[model samples]
Target: MLSLQLIRDKKEFVAERLSIKNFDAANLLNEITALDKTRRATQSELDELLSKANQLTKSIGQLYKAGARDKAEAAKSRSAELKEQTKVLSAKLSETVELLNKKLVELPNIPHESVPAGHSDADNETVYEEGEMPTLPEDALPHWELATKYQIIDFDLGSKVTGAGFPFYRGQGARLQRALINFFLDEAIDAGYLEYQPPLLINEDSGFGTGQLPDKEGQMYFANEDNLYLIPTAEVPITNIYRNVILKETDFPIKNVAYSNCFRREAGSYGKDVRGLNRLHQFDKVEIVQIEHPDNSYATLETMKEYVANLLRKLELPFRILRLCGGDLSFTSALTFDFETYSGAQKRWLEVSSVSNFESYQANRMKLRFKDKNGKMQLAHTLNGSALALPRIVASLLENNQTPEGIKIPKALQRYTGFDLIK
Candidate 1:
């Protein structure tokens, strides 16, 4: 969605930035630029022909009025020739524009200056840690095993009824899930995020508005019968509410929070990491989205990090924050921070949230612009984060708070759960 003019002006800079993501943007930029030039040239030529045709028509009308029927007829033939030329040029312009747009969709967002260069999660840097990693009892087992003994989560039933990675919560496990969702939503509201109940399915425009189409299409469940796709995240529907909208400067920073059950295909994923509540085809999450002035977006990123960190603190779980490397970053995010909680029984850290600043990348695609103080329209910055994801958070809480008597509920959610312990 980058303006070709912007690409023309900052080609080298953008190329260098994308290099961090191992993306060579130079060739694509050149191709886009050439296509733009070709489209523009075709348009200009077509406009000239139309202008000539209009003039000829006017002359023909005057000739007809003057009883010069032969002259009028000659001009009509010339106009027909011009019309055919316009048609050909119009088709070429359309074809070139389409190709250029396809290339634009393939390009990832330019990395921010501070982003570290690397590929994959292995390159991500640990930027912060909170609380001590707790030692588990010698007999501690992973959350999946504990759920079996406690008769809380019924994975086999979920598989039989639906599919893998969709576990049915039973007894206190269901209560805990509901409690965490309520707690997270309440926290988000306290932070000034207006709650939104967005739809769980979206049309094609909604998907493209959030950059989910043209690339991640296979990662979503397509309901071809209705021409809709099941939402992969709340951000898709919630943020797309502003698509094609023009706002006054004061309308930002627009903040919204929503909870949704996300559906993902996870087409090629499997194995150990997909175990238990790790990777799932369906999961619950509370999401926060913000629209801000471009100048303040990076600053807002820090505030978001603190907000999610506070959430983990309220739950009394050990967590750490990692700055995603270029390779590990999402296609549209310029920068990202992921939070992971230590699962004592599992003897590992489980990712619970990821906060990202998309800068103007998404805004451009959405056509979400705001008038600056001077009344000039500009792209707004967009950011979103998972305040908390259910499965892993449930995993971490169940494993970390386990005791022989029962599972201890975090003090913050005790009232919501209606009990301090689940025996």
Candidate 2:
């Protein structure tokens, strides 16, 4: 949620920036301003009426003490009328506030000034590219084919047990998945992030706190009976840990990491791209979240981006980083850098991680604040990224590292996997 005060002070500026996100803010902003004005006016009237009522009560007491019963009765009657008026004004104020909040939540976070103006991913700017594209033999198979050849991942078996997009990882595939999770978690801990094992199920407020409620409603799996949502990412649960919290200046750089089984209802998704380990209903991801002082948030973003890049580098995979154009950026992020790894068989870059600086967007919604050196409480900046999502990373690893002998595991992950190759 945006700060109403910021909107009031910079309506035009805010509206203009929102345009970069492809949001039409003119009508919404106008309605919010009108509603806010009515709410404030109603509140002011209620305050004045209450003040008058207090004065009338004082006069009534004085008159009654002096034995002027008639004057006291008249003041009492006026005070009763003021009470009724306040009741009506209070209802109006509540209605206006509700309407104002509805419109406010509809507005997405404004794009940062550095964000490129574009319509889609095609227009995203390539900020960095590293490693080298692996040279594979023409006979090299896609990850799915390789999985079947090695009897690693069984999609048909999974469908029989559950449904599509719920493939069963067998033997080495399952072990490799576990290995990746542990490796990512260990990397995060080494980077000074406190690891958390947050509940996989969250309430509605927790969903809304991370800006995943109304915006991505259809994309989440809800347990209707309990009204709890299966987390779409560890980011949702881990970041909400600080919801409604106020921190001191000394807690400037709060970092946390979690590995979770993310569930998503990819409602309209279809086609070849969702093949193999590309997309799934449930997947494992290691998420890194940070709450930083506003002054240091961007620096923190750089550190995070480097951390993710280093992970890919250690895996010896070819990768590139894209500075997401406004239209391609997530709703809660002001600026985002997406890391994509090349899948040799697919001949395309697969997004393995997205590091973003929400710049108080999520913090504002979560009510996560900090007291700065000047003694003023302000929204802290919140950021999160996939230290790496396993499925796609596995897909790239299999495709890019494929050899005539078998699928070779990267040296960095060999110790965790217990074996060097899935032959």
The candidate that wins on lDDT is 2
lDDT of 1 by residue, 1-423 (tens): 665667878888888888998888888888888887888888898888889989998999999999999999998999999889888888888898899899988889987887898889889999999987777788998899988988999899999999998899998999999999999999999999999999999999999999999789999999999999999999999999999999888887789999999999999999987899988999999999999999999999999999999999999999999999899888999999999999998788889999999998999999999999998999999999999899999999889988989889989999899999978
Give per-residue CA lDDT, model 2, range 211-257, as digits (tens): 99877889999999999999999999899999999999898689999
Q: Which portions of model 2 show Cα errors greater than 4 Å?
A: 54-76
Pairs in clash, predicted candidate 1:
none
**Measured by TM-score, how close is model 2 to the native structure?**
0.96
List CA RMSD, all candidates: 1.5, 1.9
> TM-score for each prediction?
0.97, 0.96
Top of the candidates by TM-score: 1
